[model samples]
Target: MKKQIALLLSLLLAPLVSAAPAPEREKAQPSAHHVAIGLPDWARGSTIYEINVRQFSATGKFSAVTADLPRLKALGVDVLWLMPIHPIGEVNRKGPLGSYYAAQDYLGVNPEFGTEQDLRDLVNAAHAQGQRVILDWVPNHVSPDNPLTKTHPEFFWRDEQGNLTPPHGTDWTDVVQFDFRVPALLDYQADVLLHWVKNFGIDGFRCDVAWGLPTPFWNEVVRRVRAVKPDALFLAEAELPQQQVAAFNLSYGFDLHHAMNQIAQCKRSASALDEAYAKIHAHFPRGAALMVFTSSHDENSWAGTEFERMGAGYAPFAVLTFLLDGVPMIYNGQEAGLDRRLEFFQRDPIVWPAETHPTTRLYQVMTKLRREHPALHTGSPMRRLDTTDNATFYALERTAADGRRVVGLFNLTAKDAKADLFDPALAGEWRDAFTGETVKLDALVPLDLKAWRYRVLVK
Candidate 1:
């Protein structure tokens, strides 16, 4: 009778035994341009924003974010990226409020924020406003307490001591890295992502540290996920231009952000951006899109805010992002000019201004202009214009084939500048995009612009 009872117990726990490596996917196609997945039609010429639910409101729930949807819509954001909504692991945590990226269960929702229904409601609310929702996916690692850590131990990297290891040379203590070479883990990861899209009506995925995983895995994941939701958008946190062929619609444009930082510090000239463009032209494939931003959740929490880096030049850099060849993103609280570095692992509500703030007004105008102008859309050709002071001032002309044209001139210096614009395209009648004032541009005329001011003219 004792032997029988012991056998029964072992049988019950057998499913939780350390997992073995699964079989590799066979007959995999080339990762490049398999079926041509591109950005959704509504996403073009639209702005995306990141939302930190834990920090977005006092209640720190999906309901709070749903209530604030109208505000985001009014601010002219088109896509909403919600940070990881999965339960955080408790075994080895970061702080009182643990990092959102540490997911203990792929299939479970974090009850501290809200239930699965709340997430569904938020996605529905966003869709009703013609906005898209993408969940932040942690594909590289999972909380050490994740069920897979015990049940599928072979899927993770174990140190010499036989304990799970974190990403090498990093202080990411809360989570353990996944072994990508374990072919079975790739299948499991892909299925976990697909479950979200199928069940929650999620429009897409903003993959975190996508570079940590093999590009082939992404190619497979993207191909498989889109097999369910054909129009699903995939965005990579990585900046490698090669990732374009890995089946991502957009990749972070770290080059532009770094160049902008240098320009703000007067360490690089306007021509410096040309180098970034050249790199893109040489490496990035035809359909690749860059996600441009002066601030993101990572940048805001780790590096200084845009106001800190750009100082007086913040607005101009913000405008430059909108006018570039990529999509522009607004971080949470950026519109209100939230000047402080928001805490990453804690409940820090955004200090929203009671009245309509200046930065908010600027975004409102830029978003509207982006929607109204065809020249500002992605793939629209840009022509570099000559300016008197290459270091303190910069100018470019964006034009569409349909005769829609926009000329953006920026004075990035701390003092006022009168830059002489020299281009035949500027010798026509134009209207200021901001003030709606009519100004005829002559190649010889120098416009007096305030410190860190930008003039966008349209004809």
Candidate 2:
């Protein structure tokens, strides 16, 4: 009887011992895997989309945009960044339509876009769809006839001649710069930002020309904004080292973006992207997130559309943006592969060029992979692995907790390239992220890349 009882105990203990080596055990231990690091409660694993309200739809109203919340949510977008919706100043406007940055009134919504009630409804609709809305805030300058100028002329930045000056070097006669030296100016601006958060439940702000403002002012503004919305995400439009000190959650990855564009245009080789990627890790402080993208409002309008800038390299470059560190973004009409550069200060709309261009399929696949893989999500640092094919192809590895590793290989040229891959740390059979096939690491991976094609493998 004693032997039988001992045998039963041994049988029960054996299963628990075997199950103890499960995924949960590895998660508890300290890890070398860059993925599985937690983002702040507010912005972890979140992706943003820039909304060009003026050209998103025919009427260019918030109500129309509100109706598309389900569509955007389905696309895996977490935050919606709306360009300035405030009233555009009529005097000294840029063109027939006027710049959105030129604000006539700070308090009122632009009637052209929608009414105050319409905007409130839009916010409500977005919230219902599990999406947060952030407004594009122009802190450095305001319309020449802004209410602040009329009420307090002393608030504006003045030159040696005591005349209101434009920000930086510009032909922007329609807007005047603000002097951050005045504490009252900061207070007023902070109060305005808080009003939106407090009244309408705005999730956050995408500060325009953020590098132009004083660091101290931004620190104060961030504090003030948080006092109302504790978990607000501040997206700085400019890429400045001091922005991290000001508690900004993210800044533009301009250096990396510039390099990627150069490679796409055939001005630089694939090695250029490696250098750019290295610089970002060197310059940006730890926990400082950079916003990565192929197209944003500034690049789309001033420079060129993605098709023009990236050309044949668009798909592979996009794959990099999605799988690499930092949050990826899709500008309005980007997923639909909008070809033309919409006029900045005009009513030019995207004609849905996806049917002909067929780039949406690439974006969808990348976005899906990003959503499914922890190795591709935020907090994972991309490490460039040694590759035999240097000129036309490169390889990178991203490891997550639980020993899951993803290897990404890119062939930037228009011909077949072979890659010799070796990593002792990588284990198990790897599967292709796009094609969903097993990849063998024992031999050279022959890739027949058509210009911008890329392959991402996961274990």
Candidate 3:
């Protein structure tokens, strides 16, 4: 009886052993591709905008977003990130509807939004407009009723009784966490990701909750995707620095976002911006790209809208993010200054019009200037200038390889503040970017900064 039991175990294990060795052995061996192939340095100077297509317009379709591309491109955006477009799960649906993150099918598009042709056309149009499109990818979990759940139940996490469990520490009852222990599951996911890049011609992926998955899995995923498309960019929705050298082109900058949030909440002075920049500059490597945003989908949905979160500091924060040594992201409707946080699991639509919005102009000017100025293009240090009154102000000058310099100053307090051109390197006859008024470096630049206004002095 013991011999028969051992024979049964061998039969069960033999297939897996034979299957795992080939892939594992291939990955274990180093290849020419093992060398770190960094993303285009030009991407360092670009800005990213998050697009929640379902909630972005009244129509909530790709056609609606395509209409706004000219405006967004005019706003100086380099990348457009469309939220998950796959079908939502109906099983154990939360709230009045299902969540976009709860993907029901990896390869299928959500017909509720539009047909696959619509997505392909969107990509083609964006490429023609010289803007890149990145799709938000949810790899950690899937909807409970996903075909994989029914067909390959062994591919997901299970208890001793083989009951599947949801992701830990949340009321996310609609989805089930995948079991990375299953090698077959990893292959399927990689293949799906590669399929979109090859078939739909997506420029990149913005992986959601990237840290939840095993690091080695990402290494494999990135490797497989790059094998098909060498120029593909990967943006991890995580703050960890380790994700940079291997799996992703950039990672989210939560610390910078926190600092700006603090300023907006009145918890910290505008000088806090310098502290945040310092932390990122010192910790992250020089070539690494940072995703700087005033607010993202998670922040808008859970915390508040950008208008609510940033308040007085909204415009200044947007400008800072664009000028800072990182890739800036504009959440959908941010240009319209949309105040209400849309429902995460329901169809909450955005209203748009032809009139110019405050944020729209602000973003347009900031992005255009950033793209035009080489000093703001790279992840380099800002030469700090001495300030006598550090209470509500911080000043720095950034120079590019071509000897072009731009002096940036900020005012955090509600009252007016003053700063003299202390750096001879930056001292010269300069013009204010906002007003286009010429001023001399010999006298103090008369600054009547409202709550969160900033000035960029160009020579």
Candidate 4:
């Protein structure tokens, strides 16, 4: 039996690296052609909250997250994106705890986090609160110590000496690349994805390095998964436009995120946001959802916290993430005003403040604005209104189909500035989103904005 298994592995790995024939449904789908997928109705006005389970609490357990669901629901989180829950591979691990991306088993829950029952309880609790849960799934690679390396050696890419290799052009020596050329590997991956949806009742997945895999694989996976759960949501951790075509409902808005950073540091003007939006509009298909944010796990651990990167302009940028024509995401601890970079490989829990932080209130206001106003929902029409000082002042109006309107004015610089907001669209009675004061805007209204201040006017 052992000799026969070895021979089977050799046969599977003999072919040159190439994508297997796409599933029958993908036969007519061109690689570059994009067709916008229908988004789940529940996500139309939803906000995503990313959870770093390892650093979310002192215990770093699923039970801890379960205990905090009420607070998250009150914070207006609609989707809870949990980081990988699989056991980490020990061989060639980066630090004492190892990277969460280094999966030792696809089917096993990490004991460090909790038992499988614990994860199920967390998902059930989230579902009871009307919040969707998506697991972070790494498809491009796996830890060298993964069980598949021994049970199905042909599933991995090997060097000339038949040694498993890391992904090309990266120092990620801990994880070995997967060979999607083998048809059976795709079947295995699909089964693993279905297992979670069927058993644990996870809503969908947030695929890591989604761009690394072939589009055909995603198309097939989406078809298979949705066959079971039609409303499953797929979020690609990439900005590639093609990924949104019939596979993923949302993709990361990295370009806009970078533009926000540049504007905050004065390396670019507020007009840079316009440029970024133009590119996004030109590239992505209409009705495609984009997830926009100022900070994430990668930004917090490798780059810096939003406080360190955006400095005084952090609040304004956070406001933009909500106001923009995309779904907004809040990284864990962001509401608590987490200032320091988190250790990626060690046990470093977020230090939550005893009292509610001011940032929490800011988020509450923004989230309330998002939930209550259809005009601010994803896929709503957003028009950039011209201002006198386009370099420092950014103004835009979002209008929903039902005639509701929300206008935002942002001072993207550190210096106080005044600009004339003159547009027929700006003529209306508006209430402040933060303060309840009412104001009227007429033709050519002159506005003085303090450094890094932002105003959200609802009509």
- TM-score, per-candidate, Cα-based: 0.91, 0.87, 0.89, 0.94
Clashing pairs in 1: none
| Model 2: how far residue 162 lies from native, Å | 2.7
lDDT of 1 by residue, 40-148 (tens): 6667788888999998888889999999999999999988999999999987798887999999999999998899999999999999998999999999889989999
Candidate numbers, best TM-score first, in rank order: 4, 1, 3, 2
lDDT of 4: 0.89
Candidates ranked by lDDT:
4, 1, 3, 2
Candidate 3 clash figure, as a count: 0
C-alpha-based local distance difference test score of model 1? 0.83
**Which residue pairs come into collision in candidate 4?**
none
**lDDT for every model?**
0.83, 0.76, 0.77, 0.89
Give the CA lDDT, 0 to 100, for residue 90 in model 3.
92
Q: Report the poorest 10 consecutive residues by lDDT, candidate 1.
A: 22-31
Regions of model 4 farther than 4 Å from truth: 1-34
Candidate 3: global Cα-lDDT? 0.77
Tens-place lDDT per residue, model 3, 197-277, is 989999899998787776678888898998888778898877655566578888888888998888777788767777876
Per-residue CA lDDT of model 4 for 168-286, tens digit only, reads 66799999988877799889999999999999999999999887788878889888999999999999988877778779999899899999999999999999998998887777766
Evaluation by lDDT, superior candidate among 2 and 4? 4
**Candidate 1 residue-wise lDDT at 356:** 82
